[model samples]
Target chain A: MTPKISRFFAEHRPATPCLVVDLDVVESRYQALHHNLPSARIYYAIKANPAPQILRRLTELGSSFDAASIEEIRMCLAAGATPDRISYGNTVKKVSAIREAHELGIDLFVFDSMEELAKLAEHAPGARVFCRLTVENEGADWPLSRKFGTTTTHARELMLRAATMGLRPYGLSFHVGSQQTSVTAYETAIARASALYRDLQDEGLDLQMLNLGGGFPARYREDVPTIGQFCTAISQALTEHFHNDLPDILVEPGRYMVGEAGVVSSEVVLVSRRGGAPTDPRWVYLDIGRFGGLAETEGEAIRYTFRTPHDESDPDHSPCVLAGPSCDGVDIMYEKARIPLPNSLRDGDRVDILATGAYVSTYCSTGFNGFPPLAEHYI
Target chain B: MTPKISRFFAEHRPATPCLVVDLDVVESRYQALHHNLPSARIYYAIKANPAPQILRRLTELGSSFDAASIEEIRMCLAAGATPDRISYGNTVKKVSAIREAHELGIDLFVFDSMEELAKLAEHAPGARVFCRLTVENEGADWPLSRKFGTTTTHARELMLRAATMGLRPYGLSFHVGSQQTSVTAYETAIARASALYRDLQDEGLDLQMLNLGGGFPARYREDVPTIGQFCTAISQALTEHFHNDLPDILVEPGRYMVGEAGVVSSEVVLVSRRGGAPTDPRWVYLDIGRFGGLAETEGEAIRYTFRTPHDESDPDHSPCVLAGPSCDGVDIMYEKARIPLPNSLRDGDRVDILATGAYVSTYCSTGFNGFPPLAEHYI
Candidate 1:
């Protein structure tokens, strides 16, 4: 019987230091998301592995893009994504990037400050803007209230300023923060945004888009909510707040759209005794380190499933620390996890670290310590 | 008067994140090493930064190189380092890389196993070999007893195996570990390797080199020993062991050669209130992160000094959490460090993180969550 890992290895042997994207999984995920969130438009955040092949696959699945930089915006455009569908969503805007956005015919951009608003006005006088609101959420795993957005009180004034400058404030957006586990956080942000929307309407302002900035958690583990449940809650909140007659909703799901679609495959250079303890042992160090797939969870003990190239029925399992080739002890991915490996695992045993689709390939410290950038292979 | 950061910043203040190298400090460091260890050959480990300009400067100063991979070996060669002056020091070798080293006329390589020796023989028939001995110093901060190097018994056998295969067993090498605080760790490793060298000589093998691998600590903080003292102890030990008739001593000094020569200059994007007493709170998130200069020391709270762009004299000090632009909370460089910043630090304040030369640029993760690579500038 063919092993699951052997199927992947059969298609491609471990290309030394490479990031492999599972196209089948990506396509299935895209279909699932589209099926689940029919009312909402999905925008793939280009920051997660901006390989052209990945971008092209995403675009083919009828996904728009969330671009934070000019380079990202260009990547989306080059990948045949329509400029009108791309949103230049970075709160901070360089004058040159703003001008480039305008030249590229990107209609939507986000602004957080009056200074930024003025700069946007000078660079792109008729750009459509989204006023980012700082929502206070005590329950967020990662609170973003301290950076990138203005308070609700300040956001109202910023929106008014944008109106005075003849900039079209088409939408109101707020990010509950990255990796938000609480579904209630999204409900609260939407309620606050709805109040602001109602207030703006009462004050004789017309708004047509309510972009609840995406933090729909991807299932890094099996416990996270499915996209269907998340979208259902969001749809219910919109119905309760705006009577189902509200503006178009935009959801920018970065990891959710792509996280599971990517896998980082590495060869086991040597399997040796790390000599920590029998219970909580040391590791079987890989060629990749924090410079690769492990960049997603830098300081945390992230769990990654490791399997050998030729293993069928319940491959031999052991808890081993995963370390990189760099001399630094801090260069670890999964400190301790039950990894399934062949009993015959030796030097040159190929291992696949699963479900690293988002934020792994693109964000790693590529040029650090002269370690080469992860080679990318798209299936 | 011109601001200190003005010398590094480009026109229009583009947010091109950069690592800056100070030539004056690097030259002084080189001079200090030359002055103290006049008889010892310094092989600057190219794995530190491997920036072409830095490599060229070190080569010009008569420093040899220690390369870990074919890529690193190629980089040193491209930077004008002769193969004779380069050591293929990494213990594990790919067949192709071994063949490349042999074809390039590079003779010095390290091996820890007989299997590796067999490959080395098949690939590079007449290559000079070094048996990397494992010195198990349990009390040392960096206990590298598990990886790469062979045990004393294994080292002897590997030496014998190489000699049987007609390979020149010319030397013994051992790395105490990175950032080793115990100066005596070197004495221990040297003693063990000396025993191995004598054993090989007793067996009719004439050893010509003692490659004492780098663990020499840089003065990261005032508590760490100065390089002067480190060199003195190692120099004294070599003289004692070989009675001033030592067969060419080679030291691989990576961080010590370049750690103090680099500085990371960044703009403060936001100053947030987090992770300290509410009454006397402390935190400042910079645009740079653990993904940049702090990549080498991920979890540990690194001791670093910071200075304002304009004011260098009044080092307004406070301990604050330094974080990167990534939404991940663990994207912290220093969770706490007394940074000399003005009390009025806000968004757009410029900061220079000093002594980032050695491992900063090389091991950085780029574009995690779409953040761009730190722009690099060499003086």
Candidate 2:
């Protein structure tokens, strides 16, 4: 456990099923990213953890905002983010919201489809818009399907269309997917962006920026390189691809900044064996579930490393099936995680879920089966 | 399309990505339940679309409530439901919430665990509690796992223990799961409850009630028997199994009472055919997604019926992948639903998602990627 996490719990004694975010760690991560990637301007994607406290802290540290919705834009503004510092990053936005964002003086936006481009042209004329270049990325925990970006050929056509429609075809943006671990993915995505930048320039439309969209991996149950390592790979790739004289580069890093900064402390609501046998994975239910946060566990794709008060080194420790405290049977954490849970484990035992700062609260359903969303405690 | 649905849209023309709940249908469904299942007292499960207007309409029709959390219980009370008329239906609850419910004069609650029983025995001394019986319910779209219940032998021991702890072991309960199509599932679950009831009575502890927990079906993409057919099967089984002096039967119908009463009108945000072929699944993106409202589509478990303006007989139509308007890839609704769509369908085209009253708004995430939770429009 980190010192801030230990000290925060010791001082506050916050209730179980609460998310404790260590701002000190968030600052340290930000500092590391700033030091390593000096060329790239960071736009903290607010959807990762749009908590006002996190926003204010990131704002103070001079982080710009990548807002997906008007609500997030409002949140960023509340944290003192100006329109220029905030980009309407979501391409799949309501046409009405386009006008609203334009009215709010948010000029920079991302658009992929002809429909979105038309909406942008009609509503937010002369606005700076980036075309998303689709890249098939592997090794990402959540492989963002081919939903947002487009093929290079299609992207070229869209950028040309954007220029013709009186909108500034500003730049090229690409996302390799969420929790992207492989440094090679960034190198590949940057290379693709470089090729697109050169292609657009060849057509007389000078793409001003290269938006290196987020996929920065956070340390969870998986092994991922540190921010410095990721930055080193990225810096090298940028130097090689851009040939030293680089245009304005931007990154919307969501998970990397906040994922490790927050931890969720949940309570074991029930400890029961499904069947009579000791070998049967002991069914452990926590007070928190997908609706109460930890939604990344949808389909058991991403498993956050956990710390139980019980010692697994004990001989009695065994594999267990974990579930959330809800009437819904789908509220399961794991079918089987071979960890040393105390044989005498009972209700109310604390289970600390680590590295949950990204997409936890924002993904939480309003209230499902009476289970309220996870309460956040920022220290 | 239902007549009321058309009238609702014609009269109001509510914005896309909105929930339109028709009170007339809710009242009509209630009337049918009252007529068919006369012996069973109905409790509207608040977790299924906890809109205040729906609650008030149900309350005005003399319907009781089944609340999952303290917040739900408070909503019921605020909507004019008496404390005695509301049952704390969720088996998994916090000890503090149990205390809060007891303090609020919620006399009835459900418990399945010894840990919860102990908490209840201390917090709410004389509260009437029901022990849930585990059943393997077949033909249920959402099959409830054994996470909330125990076997007959275990439940008997729990009820006996409840009596010893100075709490009223008032009844036995079992759920056949949500969207249960086969009436046989109810019959089988009822038989299990009857056997448990008899065993408890023979042990010198008389059970006062039988909670035939929710599993009632809603009209979706699949074929399901009418409410009358389900009630007949349940009624026959109850009459045969109880022998004489039938206990006060309670049915917590959440989806059944409201599912068909509401419709979600979402705009087609984008239409993209991923592969360059007519056979490729046409990808249609909507303004709302899993995070917005259609969370029952988690794993595509509950496929709600959809109404598009395009003609199915058109030779140009093809199989489609329906997705929500979000940056996340998982916001997809259908990977391959062979629904005919106009190949020319573009952004802002309205698609009516039917029979979505239950588990729609309550299951929606707060807001993801700037798409706000489904706005409720009560007509």
Model 1 interface CAPRI class: acceptable
Candidate 1 yields a Cα-based lDDT of 0.71
Native-referenced DockQ of model 1: 0.26
Backbone clashes under 3 angstroms, per model: 14, 1
- Fraction of true contacts retained by every candidate, in order, equals 0.24, 0.50
Native contacts recovered by model 2: 0.50
- Per-residue alpha-carbon lDDT of candidate 2 for residues A1-379, written as tens digits (9 for 90 to 100): 5798988887887887888899888888788888989888899988888888999999999999999887788889899988899999887777777888899999999987777888899999999999888886797889884677777877888898899999999999999888888889989988888987888899999788999899888888767888888889988898899887798989889899999999999888767653434554577778888778777888787788878776664456666777887667788777755445677677777888889888887788878875667788888
Chain A only: list TM-scores of all candidates.
Answer: 0.89, 0.96
Model 1: residue A150 alpha-carbon error in angstroms: 7.1
Question: Which digits, one per residue and each the tens of the lDDT, describe model 1 over residues B1-379?
Answer: 0133346555435454677776656667777877887877888887777888888888788788888778888888898889998988876666777899899989988877665687788889988998787775543343445555667776787788888897999899888876677778887777778777877888988788888887665555546777778778887777777775677788888777777777777777656442212433445667777765566545453455676754655456455656676545466666544454565676567777766777778666666655677777767
Q: Candidates' DockQ values?
A: 0.26, 0.49
Number of the predicted model whose TM-score against the real structure is largest: 2
